[model samples]
Target: MTDSADTLRARLTEAGRVCGGWCTVHIDFSEDRENPEGLAESRRRSVRDRLNRMGADDATVAAIEDALSTPSGLPSPFSRFLLARDGEVAVDEAVPGAARGETLEVGVLPRLAPLIATGVDEFPYLVVRTSRDGGDVAVHRTGAFFPESTASVEGRTDTLHKVKGGGWAQLNQQEHVEELWKQNQQELSAEVDRLVREVRPRLLVVSGDVKARRLLLDAVGQAARSIAVELDANTRSDGTDAARLDAFVAEQVAAVEQRDRADALDLLRSRVSQERAAADVGLREVVGALQQAQVDTLFVDVAALDGETLLALDGVPWVARPGDETGDAEAVGEVPAAEAILRAALLTDARILTATQQATGAGAAALLRWPAASVTGA
Candidate 1:
């Protein structure tokens, strides 16, 4: 179990059931590897400082400190760390290669909400590379493989051909070789299709022998091809340069992520004029749509989260505006507006896209699952 939005939301919901001081920590393990322990200690201090500010009991704070100090028990080298503990109940998981920087938060159930939101936006993908003889397929997210789903296929290659003098014989051998190659391509394509359906990757990367890649692409459905990102480098059954391959894969992933983010922003902008019902711009409107569980996709500006305030009234998050009142409910506390929006989206199962280039003036927008009028009676 990787730390996905659904997993984090489920865990956070479960933690919410137990009423106690919860500690959440986000750390980047990618910095200063030569002094990993030093980084860990620094993050620990940060977490402790936040816990102290929260006015948590000494024993509860101590428990959280002990949990962070212990090993994460993850098999891979994770870039981001998220740990939440409330008394005896604890949930800690490593997010592999997703954290861009270090952050720490200590609060109630949704303290690590930002991490979950960003994890979903990482855009996990599947890469399939095939040749006439065989192929390999693997699922990757934020530069790390899922490991269990990584697979390969092998087939026989025909190398036997007649001499030049035997024209007809040579032609016959060529046809046989072509048949074998076609069969290999079909088999590889089917495997790739199966993985695509199983993984439902945000992007598909295909590379290897030029002819084989073309044949496999033709064999696969158009839907898979639509998301496919073609690469020039061919990976062999016998391993290739590890560093070079890693760099290539990372570059492709980054490209796809940027493209997707741009597309999402474009979609929101395009829909604003012709289909006002489908798009909601600005923070309050987006929050309103989210509260009704009508948002299909949430587009948040990368800097939207910073310095924005939200009110958490009885565990339900509301966007903070001047003179806003809880009415019959009592306000629990204030939280980051971005985190509140993200938590609401996760709970409603809406997709999130963080925009880095284009900024919606109010810092956020949303494409609703239903028309705005239907949800808000506009």
Candidate 2:
């Protein structure tokens, strides 16, 4: 089974109960300059160094070492190494999707809650380029790229001769040629709509014949046009500049990410002003809403995940103040507030959106599935 955010959350919750040590390691496999053997060895050494710095117990360290020594036998572009031991609770698996950069994390529980929240950062997008007669389309997700679908439309090839360059016959033939081009555009537009519905990409990038592109755009629905990013560069079905295409896609992806973040923040601000129950701002309110499975979309500052702590009271997480006396007061120590909230969101199957500090000044906020009662009452 895939190691999704839900599975990771369940594993962490189960592992948290076990009385033992845990180690989490994240390695970037984006470097293609080195050979496979050398890269694996380097990653292993890096994990060992991180473990050594933590001064982990012998059994825990041995388990991690053994797990790392054995290959997964599957092609994994990214790496997330997790190991825990408490009478047989060992989590050793390589996560499939990760962005570029080295992220090494080790803690008593899997320090992967934040990663789950940021999963959307790797969501796929569709790229389509139309040609004179046909077009090529591809899907890009995470670090993987694959062709999704293709389209083709035939147009008039023969040239019509004019009678002394002024004849109704020549004009009629020109209109016929234009009609064929319109038909081609219509066919491509229908295909685009189908692909968008199936893939639900975060962005749609289109580049190719200008007239065809315009006609297709006009034919496509508003939803498709809303997310579409038109490229002015020349492209064809058989030949394409790989480097230039990659750069263009990367730039569009960054722009889409920025827009998404800004939109989430804008919604948060709007909701806060209205004092709407469906939107929550600040840590305490957001945590409470999450615990109730009321959150629809959670917007959290990346820095906030490591800034605050939450106490687990009778296995239920809560954001308690210094002298607050709630429940049995039987504290189960403290866990990262971000992790606790993330765990709750996963359990409820809510969407998680990571925002910048400037966007989420209160550390965390959430859009609820339904209106929640006042936090004071809860």
In model 1, pairs of residues that clash are none
Clashes of each: 0, 0
Judged by lDDT against the true structure, how good is candidate 2? 0.63
Instruction: Give the residue spans of candidate 1 off by over 4 A.
Output: 1-20, 35-78, 87-101, 113-124, 141-145, 157-172, 274-277, 302-305, 315-330, 356-358, 370-378
TM-scores of the candidates are 0.76, 0.69
Candidate 2 residues lying further than 4 Å off, grouped into runs, are 1-23, 34-36, 48-108, 113-118, 121-124, 140-180, 275-277, 304-307, 312-333, 370-378
C-alpha lDDT score of every prediction, in listed order = 0.66, 0.63
Range of the 10 consecutive residues with the lowest summed lDDT in candidate 1: 313-322
lDDT of 1 by residue, 233-268 (tens): 666645554456666777877777777767877777
Task: Supply the global lDDT for candidate 1.
Answer: 0.66
Q: What tens-digit string does per-residue lDDT give for candidate 2 at 190-291?
A: 777887888688888988878768877888888789889888766765555655766788799878877876787787777766744578888888877866
Range of the 10 consecutive residues with the lowest summed lDDT in candidate 2: 155-164
